[model samples]
Target: MSFFSEFREFAVKGNVVDLAVGVIIGGAFGKIVDSLVGDVIMPVIGKIVGGLDFSDYFIPLAGQTATTLAEAKKAGAVLAYGSFLSVLLNFIILAFVIFLMIKQINRLKRETPAPAPSAPPPTPEDVVLLREIRDALKR
Candidate 1:
């Protein structure tokens, strides 16, 4: 077969198509999770932690205008460990969501019906007839 035929076959497979769709959706889902982390959760956390903005928190290795952590990075200063903390929080949320998904999937798998037990083998017809004949002889 030609390369185009092989490509067509590859593209048409159900699993491959499903994977492509899943990747697209997963990218969108990642953005949503990022937004949730950045917008909703972070602000609440900042308030709880004494009005601290994570994105603004960074350490400047070298700079004059770096009056605070935020100013350093905004002024293009390097060595920002504080930003790492914000990313770490995002990772934690993502992990929790994945864990919950796996747990639900596992629960569904457990609830599905198992294979039925096999029936026992039947007794042979010849054995039954012989038993009846022996009983008649005795009678």
Candidate 2:
């Protein structure tokens, strides 16, 4: 087969298509989680912790006296631990959500009973005749 045909066959497979769709959905889901952590959760946490913005909490490594993380980076090197904390929180939330979803899916799967076993097919006529002949010869 030609290379294009082979490529087409591989790309059109069910698993490949499913993986592509999963990647697209995962990207969108990551964005939602990022927004939740950055905009909603982080702000609430900051408010609870004496109204300090977590994203601005950084250690200056190059003696730069910048106040915000963005400004610090522009001035010199800095360790942005607060940004890391937000990302870590995002990961935890995403993991928890996925765990819940998987748990629910597993529960649904368990609720569905398996199909009952089918009865065996009847013996063929030829086999039955052969058996009768063997029985007669033994008699």
Candidate 3:
């Protein structure tokens, strides 16, 4: 077979299609998670932690000391721990969501009814007659 045909066959496979769809969905899901962390969860956390903005929290190194994180970056190297914290939170939330989804899927699988057992095939008439003859002889 030609390489193009082989490639087409591989691309048309169910697993490959499923994987592509999963990747697209996962990208969208990541955006949702990012928004959840940055817009919703982080704000609440910041409020609880004395209204501190995580993005603005950084350690200035090398250059002149600046008040804000952006200023510090402009001046010199700044360790952006706050941004790291936010990203870490986003990862944790995503992992938790995936875990819950998998758990639910497993639960659904467990709840589904198993297939019914099939009935055994009927015995042949010849076999039945032979068995009857053997029984008569024993009697």
Top candidate (TM-score): 3
- RMSD over all Cα atoms, model 2: 2.6
RMSD of each: 3.5, 2.6, 1.8
Q: Which 10 residues in a row give candidate 3 its minimum summed lDDT?
A: 58-67
For each candidate, what TM-score against the reference?
A: 0.76, 0.83, 0.89
Alpha-carbon deviation at 108 in model 1, angstroms: 0.7
9-120 per-residue lDDT for model 1 (tens digits)? 9999999999999999988888888899889988998999999887767656665466576567667756766568777888898899989999999999999999889897
Ranking of all candidate structures by their TM-score, best first = 3, 2, 1
Query: What value does the lDDT take at residue 128 in candidate 3?
Result: 99
Model 1 per-residue lDDT at 30: 86
Residue 99 displacement in candidate 2 (angstroms)? 1.0
Clashes of each: 0, 0, 0
Candidate 3 residue lDDT tens string, 38-78: 99999999999899888788877776578888788888898
Clashing pairs in 2: none
